[model samples]
Target: MSRPRRFLPSVSLLTAFEAVLRTGSTAAAARELDLTQGAVSRLVQNLESQLGQPLFLRERRRLIPTEAARAYGRDISRALDLVARASMELAANPGGGVLSLAILPAFGTRWLAPRLAGFLSAHPGITINLATRLKRFNFAAEGFDAAIHFGVDDWRGAGHLRLFDETLVACAAPAFLRANPIRQPADVHALPLLQIETRPTAWPEWFRAHGLVAPLPRGMLFDQFAPMTQAAIHGLGVALLPEFLAMPDLDEGRLQRLPGAPVSGTGSYWLVWPEARADYPPVVALRDWLAAETADLRAREGAGDGADDGDRTRTP
Candidate 1:
């Protein structure tokens, strides 16, 4: 199953070629690699000899990479990054397993972070590293073992495990609500409305669920829920927030639920991994742990416990 010897370039040759292509000169590549200019030029020449083609076009004193060489450099750069990441991980965790997970910011901080200790306690040999990623990414290029996805199960070539559906509550600061009382669902439009960037149609959808269908006024737009939640706490505007995110603030009297029933958001939470990593040991362990952790929420959702009287029947 090994590739032909000619197809596999040495790391030194690849590094030199990639550096020259990226830096646009052998002098710059030499500075980066801490090698003399002549040494770097030699490495490039050796690589070209091995490949049986000229990768660069010499004009005056400049070296311009050919179009084909530019494309090949892109692949080489990715391969080098992968190798570096692997080397770093191996050095950091020597004998232990490492799982690099991409997570949604609010969900990671409010939900998963609190319960992660239990998972780590159960599997002491596994180390989980988390990074915030708000949108989908190329798994092969990013080098993540798994990601926390908040949407429909539509990640092609990835295996999904349902976590839980989110229930959204329209809420505002207690002072703001007292200042502009919400007597009905339509009253929400009278005040400033905050919107999360990820959920563009949330306000419209929430209004439609309450039998009030019309174009909504644009308000402040936030990229993440954390800042939006804080803005609502400071009486900036009413925000549609997930119940889990809003519960603590509501209980502490920082925010008050608007005069409307809770409605299901347009998406559900999921633990997704590339199909190639479906059976990875760390991934499998985390999947099993998440399934157990979300069992209660799943049960409540199935029994209609998470729904309200008004929009309980609507699917997420």
Candidate 2:
């Protein structure tokens, strides 16, 4: 509960301690930090004196870190990573700040990427960096300002801003569907059912919703919607795809929707960030932009924008 500076130890002291602990030698630490071995050793000594504890056991020519030193190194490593990332961001954009985001692959490419130009145009000062994340990650550890999360509002230790619910449709390449005609919902069980790895029960749940009960058909597994949709386009099998993703193909006659009605997915996409950073400027800007974007999408869908599938974005 006490501040780190209350101990009166310099950051250099802690840095030296961490480096020596990790590299297992003052000479190695010095080489890594571009400092002399003597200076590195002196920094470690200063830290030990400040803490009033023996950090290492010296055996003739060898120095072995004590348990306390190892524990301290572990704690400071994460803090050092945070400092390094922050410094890198500041250096990369000297005029302003960077909003490093973790995004779902398919949603980012198909939905967000196409709509991102508006946000960039609106916020000229902030640099937005995006990386695809297939699963939930710790924002603090991962150095992400926010994430495009697709699920219920259950991201632990985070603030959630609801984006929109996902809508799924059964579709495949027209050639595949034509070759294996589907007259009823039960017909899907016989087809090569392409499965989304994250939503293992989606096919079965869709069938159950359609009043058709059967064992889940096993088939080719895809981790993300992009490849799954591509596989379907190549006539690999029937894919349960998001309408938005399938819209371009369907409209261009590349893919065809099966007979079942559009199925509402169980989860919603959300803009999630560390609750502590709810007031961060860059995060606020992104969240506001996404709010407006999804609103426009829903409005268009409500207005019977029948040409395209209503936003079909999904997380891995």
Candidate 3:
């Protein structure tokens, strides 16, 4: 009828085991833990005795971890990281917390950077850190509180709020446009059309939307728009660029829109965070502020004329 006692290893024993496994020697582990080498050895021996297994193989002066110890070290690595992060957070934000965000490079620079000042101004107590991540990542493992994600609402294990759809317009450098002189959507097929690896069907979809059948030949491929826009400006070829990313170049007379109306791409930007942190204050504040900003931008877009195509454009 009595409950069985739980047998948990002491923190020192676990730390010694992890340190020895990581450094491959008790001496190194002792140096790392700031303890005597004899103490570290005793701790590891105690841990092995408690677990009833040999964590290390003794060969002369060398200590080699068994496969089981190797796996255990890997498991404890993440736990140790979380502990360190928690300690650092406690030290850094005694009065508040930090919000770490992962963002796409082009979108972050062109869109989010301009708006981040307002967010920081309002949330003066919270420290906001931004890192550029071109691909989706594990939020918990990477220590991100939220991310600016593009594409559909399919980031596995995260809750997403749609920010804005992407509108892609065909663009070329002014000199390239002058020399190429594309008159209609069909004229684009004859030129070197730059392609974005993420959106392979952009050109074909645009052509289809305009009632034209494009062969959609392969062209020079670039991963991100910052470089792709630069390539287009340097007269590499015409590129299908998001209207917002292309605006500065258009205004500076570095790039020009190819003949035809801008077509909608099949993706949108989303503010994504882990579902478990849905009600967390920082995440909620960011989500609500983003929603308001998106609504205001949409209202402006709706009221704008074609003169500022960047503001007026939206993807389907």
Best by lDDT: 1
Which pairs, if any, clash in model 3?
A: none
Report the C-alpha lDDT of model 1 over 1-316, residue by residue, as the tens digit: 8898788989999999999999999999999999999999999999999999999999998999999999999999999998998898888887767899999999999999999999999999888999999999999889999999998777878887778888999999988888998899998877888998899888888999999874566679999999999999999999999999888899999999998899989988888888878888999999999988988888888846333211111112
The candidate that wins on TM-score is 1
lDDT of 3 by residue, 69-89 (tens): 898878777777877876887
Tell me the spans in candidate 3 whose CA falls farther than 4 Å from its real position: 1-11, 49-52, 298-316
Query: lDDT of each structure?
Result: 0.89, 0.83, 0.83
Model 1 residue 165 CA deviation in Å: 0.6
User: Predictions ranked by TM-score, top down?
Assistant: 1, 2, 3
TM-score winner between 1 and 3, please give it.
1
Each candidate: RMSD: 4.9, 5.1, 6.0
For model 1, how many clashes? Answer: 0
Clash list (residue pairs), candidate 2: none
Model 2 over residues 1-316: C-alpha lDDT tens digits? 5687747577788788888888989999999999999999889888888888899999986789888778877878888888888899889887757898899998888888998999989988889999999999877778788999887767787877777777889998988988998887888888888988888778877888899885656779989998898999999998888777788888999898898798877677888888767778898889888878877656644634332222222332
